[model samples]
Target: MRAKRTPVLDRACRACGFSDSRGLTHAKLQSGETVTLCGTHELMLRRAGGAVDAGELRGVLSDRRDTVRRSVGGGDELAESLQEAFAPNRRRTERRAS
Candidate 1:
C-alpha cells in the first residue's frame, strides 16, 4: 500500500518574507515552477505585464479590515469615559515630619 501524501504547505513571499498567503500573488514560470510575491511586489509584477488576480488585492484589504474590527470592540467608549470622569477622587495629604 502507498503512504498517504501530505498537503503542500505555503512558503513565505519571495519578495518580503510574509508567510500569510491571504494577499500574496503567485505565478507559474515557463519551466512550470511556481513562486509567490507580497502585495507591493505583486503590483510591480502586474504593472510589468504579469497577470495577477483582482480578487487577491481585495482579499488582502478585507482581511486587514476584519482584523482591525476584531481588535476594536463595539462597547461604548463615551459611556465608559463619562463613568470614569464622575467617579470619586481621593486626595491624600501627607503630614510633614517636624
Candidate 2:
C-alpha cells in the first residue's frame, strides 16, 4: 500500500506556512525530506544549508517582501511599451522601426 501524498500547490510552506500557488516551490533536503517552501524559505535554506526556524521566517519574509517591492516599484513600463508598439495606429511605425 502507498501513502497518499499532498499535492504540490496544496501544501503549505514547511518553514513559514505561506501558501500561494505562484510563490510556492518544492525542495529535497539532504535527509531526503521533500518540503514545500515559500520563496523566502527556499532561498534561506539554499543559502544557509538548513531549515529556517519560525523566528527567522519572519525576518526572511520581510526581507523578501522588501526586495520584491523595490524591484517591482517601477511603473508598468513594459506593459505600456508593449501596448504602444502593438497599438493599431503604430503598426506601420513598428514595421519601419524593426
Candidate 3:
C-alpha cells in the first residue's frame, strides 16, 4: 500500500509574476502543511510571518511585538541591516543625480 500524495498550495510571487512552474518553492506552515510559492512570494511571506491562517499569523505578530519593540528601542541590528540593504539604491540614485 502507498500513502496518498499531499497537494501543494499554489501562490503567486509578490515581486514578479513567476508562476509555480518557474520559481515556486515550498514553505512549511505551523500547521505542518506546505505552501508553494515563488522566491519573491516567499520573501513576502517571511516578512509577514508564515502562518497557517490569518489568525495564526496575527498571533505570531502579536507575540513578536515585544521583541520588535525592544529591537527598535536602541542598538538594533535590524536598523543596520535595513541601512545596508538600502545603501546600494541610495548610491545609485546619488550617482544618477550627479
| TM values, all candidates | 0.35, 0.42, 0.39
lDDT for position 50 in model 3 = 79
lDDT of each: 0.57, 0.66, 0.62
Per-model clash counts, in order, read 0, 0, 0
- Summing lDDT over every window of 10 consecutive residues in candidate 3, give the lowest-scoring window: 57-66
Task: List where candidate 1 sits over 4 angstroms from the true fold.
Answer: 1-10, 50-98
Model 2 over residues 30-49: C-alpha lDDT tens digits? Answer: 55556678887788877876
Q: In lDDT terms, how accurate is model 3? A: 0.62
Query: CA lDDT of 42 in candidate 1?
Result: 62
- Per lDDT, the best of the predicted structures is 2
Q: Can you list the residue pairs that collide in candidate 2?
A: none
Give the poorly placed runs of model 3, Cα more than 4 Å off.
11-17, 54-98
Ranking by TM-score: 2, 3, 1
Model 2 quality (TM-score): 0.42
- Candidate 1 TM-score to native: 0.35
